[model samples]
Structures are given as C-alpha cells and as structure tokens.
Target: MMEPETRESLIARLPDHADTTAWLEFVQLYEPLIYGIGRRHGLQPTDATDLVQEVLLAVAQSIERFKPDQQRGRFRSWLFGVARNHSLNKLRSLRGQPQPAGGSEAFKQLDQVAAPTSLEQEFTTAFRRRAFRWAARRVRQSVQPTTWEAFSRTAVDCQSAGDVAEDLGVEIGSVYLARSRVMSRLKRLVQEVSGDGFEAIEGELR
Candidate 1:
C-alpha cells in the first residue's frame, strides 16, 4: 500500500495544469493500463490509441473538479472510473456501425456488451502486471549485477537457490540473502507505484 503522504503528494499534483513534470509522470504510470483496457474490450489498434487520448483529455479537463472523499474512494479508483466511462462510450459508438461482415468474434461481442465488470478485471490484472514490471525494472538498476542475477534465477526463473549459488560463485546463503533484499525492495516499489489500494495485487505478488 502507498503511504498516505505519498498518495496525497501525487493527488495534489494531478490537477495542476502548470505541472508538466507531474502530468508526464502520471501519463507514464497510467497510459499502459488505460490503453490495455481499451484493447481488452476489443477495440482496434488505432481506435484504442484514439480512446487513450480521449480518456486522458477527459482526465485533464475534469481533474480539478475531483474532491477526494475517503467515503467515496481513492484517486486511483476515480481515475479508473473515468477511463471506464470513456471506454464504454467508445464501445457504444461502435455498436451500430457497419463492420466487414466477417468481423472477428471478439469485435462482434462488443456490440452486445452491457457491463464493465469483465473489462474492469482485465484492467486490474494489467495494472498489477505493469506495476510489477515497472518496479522490477527500477530494482534491477539499483542492485548489483550479481545480486539481481541471484534474485532472477531463484525468484523469477524458479531456479534452485543452490544451483544459482554455484553458477554465480556465491554461497547458497548469499543467494537467499540477495533474493530477500530484492523482494524487499520490490515490495516497496510496488507500494510506491500502486498506492494504498494495492491489497489485491500485493497479495498476488506475495
């Protein structure tokens, strides 16, 4: 989970039009999740890209009006709602349009879709995957090459610690220690990226 201070710092910067750096950071962190949601809902590649821009524009326009209420939800939840609505709008727009008679089954299914639950699940899964990948990248760069190799072999590649130690010319104990350190750092990075609403993802990672 993200610390309260960290969540607030990010929330505070999201609505400021002059905060280009903050906006850029926001885009980098969220664009994949948003874009993935569109694609998962069966949008064409170009249409999904267009939907991404539309959703982001909606966020920029409406962010100033968002007042965080603990009773209501977190900023991330609210952001997801915006993306969901925009995606549904895009899907609805395509419902009655002509398709090449033999369109993909996935594309046809979009016409009858009414609920967002399935797409929301996809978004959650994508978010978790992207968050871990982002954190892993950061952790890899900060750790020693040997430490990262040990962690990767044991934790990521599912290799035996004993074998990894032999390959890395380190003691078995060192491999365990390296894996522990990397896991600890990864947890911190996941929380930093995901905020307090990460219980589900964190549970999966553990």
Candidate 2:
C-alpha cells in the first residue's frame, strides 16, 4: 500500500497544477497503459508514443474541470474516453493520408479495426494487468521473504497450501495467513494506484 502522505498527496493534488509530485506519480502509473491502449488500437509504435503524449496533454488541459462524480462515473473511465477520442482522431488522420510504400499492410490492418468499446475493453485488461504487477512488486519489497514465497507459491504458482506449508517448513495455517496478508496489501495497492475511479471501471467491465 502507498504511504499515507503519498496517497493523500495523490488525492489532493492530482486535479490542479498545484502538485508536481502527484502529477509525476500519475504519469508514471498510467502512461504505459495509455501507450498500450494505443498499440492495441492498431497504432504504430511511434504513433502510440505520440498518442500517450496527446492524451496526457489533454489531461493537463482539462483536469481542473474534472470533478469526481460517483453518480456519473470514474476518473479512469473519463480518461479512457479522452484516449479513445484522441485515438480515433489519429486513425482518421492516418486514413486520409496516402499509404507509405512499405506500410500498406499495417494501414490495412488498421482499417479493419473494431469499435471503440473493443479498444476500451483492451485498455481495461491491460490496466488491470499492469496494476496487479505494480502492486505485487510493492508488496514483495515490504514483505518477509518467506511470507512472499509462501504467498507466491500458493496463490500464483498454484501450489496446494499444504504443499507450500511443507516446503516452507511452516504450519498450513501460517501459509494461509501469509497469502491473506499479501493479498490484502496487493488489493490496497491496486486501489491506491487506480484511485477513486477504479471501481466504476471495474463495474462496467463486469
């Protein structure tokens, strides 16, 4: 889980330009996911990189006006909508240009792209995968080696709890305890990284 100061900073400072720390943290956490969303939408690597910049620029331009309305939706969902609009704009521009000599096939593939919802679904999946990985890394650093191993063996490697207990020379109950603690921390970390908007996106995906 994030330190209390860090979490508070993110929550309080992310919307306006007042918090450089929070803005940097926000960019570090979401930029890769935004880039991945662009690639999944059939953008070339350079174009995807450009898309990340464009989305972040848009966020910077409009974040002050972004209120967290639980009745309406989540911040991440709003961010996703911005990304989708920018991506489609890029696609339309690309479609209007003459195909490059060697990139016609890529353009053809782009031409066959599915609807915006498909891109949104891919973005959510990618976001979840990145969030879990980031949370697991943070938890691993703070946990005891034995505790982390036990949790990984049982929850990730799919070993039986009994088997993990024996391998670690601990009681089965200890193994269960370790897994539970690690999982709880992981969930908290994911929530911290995703902020207040995660649940709304999760509900839509479900």
Q: Pick the candidate with the highest lDDT.
A: 1
> Where is model 1 more than 4 Å wrong at Cα?
1-12, 16-22, 68-71, 93-111, 196-199, 202-206
Q: After superposition, how far is residue 41 of candidate 1 from its true place, in Å?
A: 3.7
Over 1-206, each residue of candidate 2 has an lDDT whose tens digit, in order, gives 32122244354566778778778877877899888777766777888899999999999888778776532356667888888778767877887777666555555655576666787667767776666676688899999999999999997788999998998899999999999999888767766776534444344434
Clashing pairs in 2: none
Q: Provide TM-scores for the models.
A: 0.75, 0.76
lDDT (Cα) of model 2: 0.75
**Residue-by-residue lDDT tens digits, candidate 1, 141-197:** 999999999999998789999999999999999999999999988877676666634
Question: What RMSD does model 2 have?
Answer: 5.2
Off by over 4 Å in 2: 1-13, 16-21, 70-72, 94-99, 104-111, 195-206
